[model samples]
Target: MTTGIAARIADRIRHSGPVSVAAFMTEAMFDPREGYYATKNPIGAGEDFITAPSVSQMFGELIGLWCAQVWMDMGQPARFHLVELGPGTGQMMSDMVRAGRAVPGFLDAARITLIEASAALKMVQGRTLTPMGVEALWLDRLEDVPDGPAIIVGNEFLDCLAVRQAVKQDGHWHERMVGLDDDEDFTFVMGPRLGMDADLVPARLQDAPDGTLVEFRPGDRQLVDVLGRRFSDHPGRALFIDYGPAQSEPGDTFQALRGHEKTDPLAAPGTADLTARVDFEQLGALARAGGLDVDGPVEQGRWLKSLGLEMRAAALIRSAPEKKSVIARQVMRLTEPDQMGELFKVMTFSTPGLPKAPGFAPEA
Candidate 1:
């Protein structure tokens, strides 16, 4: 079935010509009337894809412990914001709250804030968190979260932010735009070449071969700036975990998924989950430029292991011996080098005076 959003996007392209990839993505994913996220639950058995939190409670619990430690590192502020970006179904937040409560005043001092754009997910989150006795306020953007001493966590969130793709041609870079193919389907077309002084292309990739595709997320950089400024202005810490490269690399990672399978990105707008790999290197640089102390863009496996994922799994397995194998599989899925462990990465930033977060070491 042709989704209404697909028709809407076609009409837009016909009227205004090709749109930037970022523009297309923003509409495809967040369009209020018929966007993918706006209309349905995009995670779980029959959904688009599943995240770590959906795979196991252990993931969120460890994050909770990490937050509690960060809270202690910050001297246990009397009132602090514990904000989560794109909290899907509120499962992770619920798990985090349960685990963090063990840290004496952690939960008592926390004011939970969730940054989510989907009204659909908000309803699901309400149902999931309310029964867990967790109270939270929601905002459509990160900036809306009242700022103070805060601990912000974003898991599998940054990749969803719209990213601009540029293709190198004749030794110069041109912006990639979404246009209609001969079949009247969405396709990537080259736009104007960027100026020599354009800040969009990373310096190292400027000399890339002709036809090289590079993707950058201006929105993600802006988000880092916002979060970094928040931490710099008011002491806080932020953690971002997502699947992407540790350093800037040349390749096209934009993709669409439906029913956990890859789909043609332009085939059916607003019906598939669209995303691109996040560049942690760019994000780290942005955070540093914004005056926050940056930490490792470490592999998720190493970071999680450092945070004691194995230990947590064992403790849980001991409690439910019969479920040992099941729990072990979940841990493996999260930390196995061949799985999410290597594919996903973890990075963090904190206020100048704050110490490095639990899973991160001092930068050399």
Candidate 2:
């Protein structure tokens, strides 16, 4: 018996020729009835996969401090938007808010906003955040965020945005699509040639050898455009921490995770989490083109260390000496080169003229 999402997708593919990978992903991940996020909480232990914020409280606390510092750099706006995109379980924001207490007036000055589409997750977030004595405004889209100076934070969020993949064939790029196979199961198929525009394939991989697969997220570009316009009208800074290469490269990184194990992305739609590697270089370029200042796509481990991850861990251990081993393991998992440390990266974008964000080097 096919899953609800799988059956729906099969029907669509049967009626239409083929759907772009991005379209397939969007439907699988966002379909109201059975989409992954729509039906379940997919973060934390025993979930599909664990995010950094779930790994330890330190991650969220450090991020909170970073935002507080940025708020100070913004000259302490009387009332500025402190927005979080795709706040998973509200753990990061909770930790951030807790840490923000370190800086007087930071919490008072913050107008907390969470941009989330999943109603189920929103309920979960409500439970997580409500007890902290912090009231938050929840919206379904970024455009709905009220106009004002803002500091946006997204952790492990960008990877969830759908991406379209193209394969180089005979020196031309063909859009990779999801189509029903002979058995009516989902499968990858090559679609129409991109011709002149090359379907917006990044220049860096335009001339890649035949058979190279390049992925691009139109959503990312659109998101940057929206943020750029928002920042242009007001002052804002945004931080995105995710796993992706610091430089753009051509490859197929589309994948799925279920119960912390890698699974076939096209096997069962809407039942597993689907994601692709973020292209930080391309993202930075888009932000720059949108007239925003971009900061390092620094390794997450280095960025966290620069923000004093070790110091924070030590403090936490000193407070709970009995949990020293557990705390040490969390730090190693978060910052060790072979672990999440090197694979994940941190980047910031701000309206031009603001001081550089914390942990990032001064502009040359």
Candidate 3:
């Protein structure tokens, strides 16, 4: 069945021309009728990957405290938005609200909003968060949330948004595309770069030699700009935790996973998880244009340590001896540079008055 899907797209390209990698990824990851995120849970043991918040409670707790700071920084707005994007199983949010109680008056002043697209995961989230005293309203887009002072968190969110790819050829960058091959299998091709993209390619990429493909996400930047502009009208901050970097570099970061195994991305359009590394630098630029104070694209390990995750973990371990192994593994996943620690980056954008956003070096 997977082979048939790949073959169909591939054959289209063979007869036609190259399709942008973005077009292919969109179909592969979100065809709705049969897409990766559309059809699969893609988390926990049965899935291709696990997210940081899922690995430990400490992660979500710290973020909870971070939001509290945003509230405090804003002089504790009587009503504010505590929003979480793509909240999975609602575990992180539950942990967040629990930890945030430490902040005096935080719970009373905030409304929890979650943007989730999966009915299956939403049910899981409902079950997990129902016990918490807080009410969580679910939505399909952040825009649905009303305008207000907000502290938003997006865990492993931006990476999954569709991205476009370009490869340097003859000192000219061409957009890499997907199309059908002779067997109707998905195939790669190059298209003439059009629109404002020619002006947007990184300066380093402009002169690169042939055969080098660069992945990018206009959708992400557009989303970032929207969120930034939305918050621009009010006072608040946004924190993004995902796999990427503080700076832009060249490489194809796209991949597919099926039951924790690497697979042909195009082979099973609806079965495998499809994702790529986020481009935080691009996000930063878009946010700035929309009028926001952008903070570090800091490494996740560094950010967690700066937030004192170690102390938090040690406290949890002391409280319960039976959970030692679980605590240890969670610590490793959040702090080990090779795991999600270093590879996953954390960044926040804020309005003018936000005190230096927690978990990173203050911007000069």
Best by lDDT: 2
Each model's lDDT comes to: 0.88, 0.92, 0.80
The C-alpha TM-scores of every prediction are 0.97, 0.98, 0.93
Tens-digit lDDT track for model 3 on 147-261?
A: 8888889998888788888887777777877765566556566788555786666554556667877777878767777777887688888899999876778898888878888
Which TM-score value belongs to model 3?
A: 0.93
Clashes of each: 0, 0, 17
Estimate candidate 3's RMSD in Å. Answer: 2.3
| Whole-model lDDT, model 3 | 0.80
Q: Put down candidate 1 lDDT per residue, 191-299, tens digits, no spaces.
A: 8886752477766676889989998888877887787778767889889999998889999899999999998987788888999998888888888888888887998
How many pairs in model 2 have backbone atoms within 3 A of each other, for residues 3 or more apart or on separate chains, i.e. clashes? 0
Q: List the residue pairs that clash in candidate 1.
A: none
Pitting candidate 2 against candidate 3, the one with the higher TM-score is 2
- In model 1, where do residues sit more than 4 Å from their true spots? 362-364
Score candidate 2 by lDDT.
0.92
RMSD of 2: 1.4
- Roughly what TM-score does model 2 have, to 2 decimal places? 0.98
Candidate 2 per-residue C-alpha lDDT over 20-85 given as tens digits, one digit per residue, 9 for 90 to 100? 989989988999888998998999887889999889999999999999999999999999999999
